[model samples]
Target: MALRAHVGKLRVHQAASEVAVESVSLARRFRGPGAAERGDQLVRAALSVTSNIAEACGRGSVAEFRQFLLYARGSAQEALSQLDIARRLEPPMLTTVIRRLESRSALVIKQLGRLHDNPPRQR
Candidate 1:
């Protein structure tokens, strides 16, 4: 199959992109001591998830793609962890949003794991 076609079929990539955008918006809500630093970390981790997946899809080999999937999974976990931390630090009003992001991150993690275990066959 063509690389473009394969990439287009990646629903996980779309999920990751959503997570990245949500994370950025959530980070903007952070306002307090050390908020800047924490937001920066969260954004970086969230961005890494999508970035790694994009890189993986562009790779020439299934092994390389799987490797980057592993990286993407790790980044998703990192982003989830940051969201948990934010949940504790932020006000009650933001809890729902943070939880939603957490759920999205979990979905991305599962999708990445599935992809890693059963990568697309190269032709």
Candidate 2:
């Protein structure tokens, strides 16, 4: 796949959007000491999940896009880590949301890995 073609996968956007949504929901549900701080972190990570992908897609080279995907993967891990903290602090309701986000992040990671491992077609 070409860089654009790989990034064009709707699953990427869907996964990111779901993370963003879950972050919002988690933010609302987890309201305790330092909750605001954790919520903000989750939000940034969620945004990074998609923003990095979009930025990579607009880059001139496949290597650049792969770098961005790497960043996005890091962000996903960050978000998941935050979710684990939230689970420890908040009610179980947030657990379900976090799990969903985790699954989505895993899927995105798979896609990113595939894109990176497979060479793009030659012109």
Candidate 3:
């Protein structure tokens, strides 16, 4: 349950990677200093999902993978919350980008839930 475990060879699931990439791209497009700061947080949380999943997959048991996946899911939620705030605080120019990021976050959450329910090798 430690948060300091090594995350090696995360399988880079298609959905999760897409979310992470979109987040990073969105982070670079913010207009204001404040929005940029929040964007950094959003970016970090988005990237966390990728790392957490990789770490989970590296774990020794299905139970452990589930545990780390929970962490990843939490990060995804955190990113979503930050995105909502960014929507209000940011300028009007980034609306489409924000919407896309939100969509990706939602997708990551759904994918994480599915994987948690049926982890690899647990069938």
On TM-score, the candidate that comes out on top is 1
Candidate 1 on 1-123: residue-level lDDT in tens?
433326657999999999999999999999889999999999999999988998999988887888989999999999999999999999899999999999999999999999899888777
Residue 48 CA displacement from its true place in model 3, Å = 0.3
Where model 1 places Cα greater than 4 Å from the true spot, the runs are 1-5
* Residue pair clashes in candidate 3: 10-54
**Which has the greatest lDDT?**
1
Evaluation by lDDT, superior candidate among 1 and 3: 1
Candidate-wise lDDT, in order: 0.90, 0.75, 0.79
Model 3 poorest 10 in a row by lDDT: 2-11
Candidate 2 accuracy as lDDT? 0.75
> Which digits, one per residue and each the tens of the lDDT, describe model 2 over residues 47-96?
88888877777676777777877888888788878877877888776677
Q: Residue 95 error for model 1, in Å? A: 0.3
Candidate 2: worst-modelled 10 consecutive residues by lDDT: 1-10
TM-score of each: 0.94, 0.84, 0.83
Candidate 1, after superposition: displacement of residue 38 in Å? Answer: 0.8
**lDDT, model 3:** 0.79
How far off is residue 110 in model 2, in Å?
A: 2.1
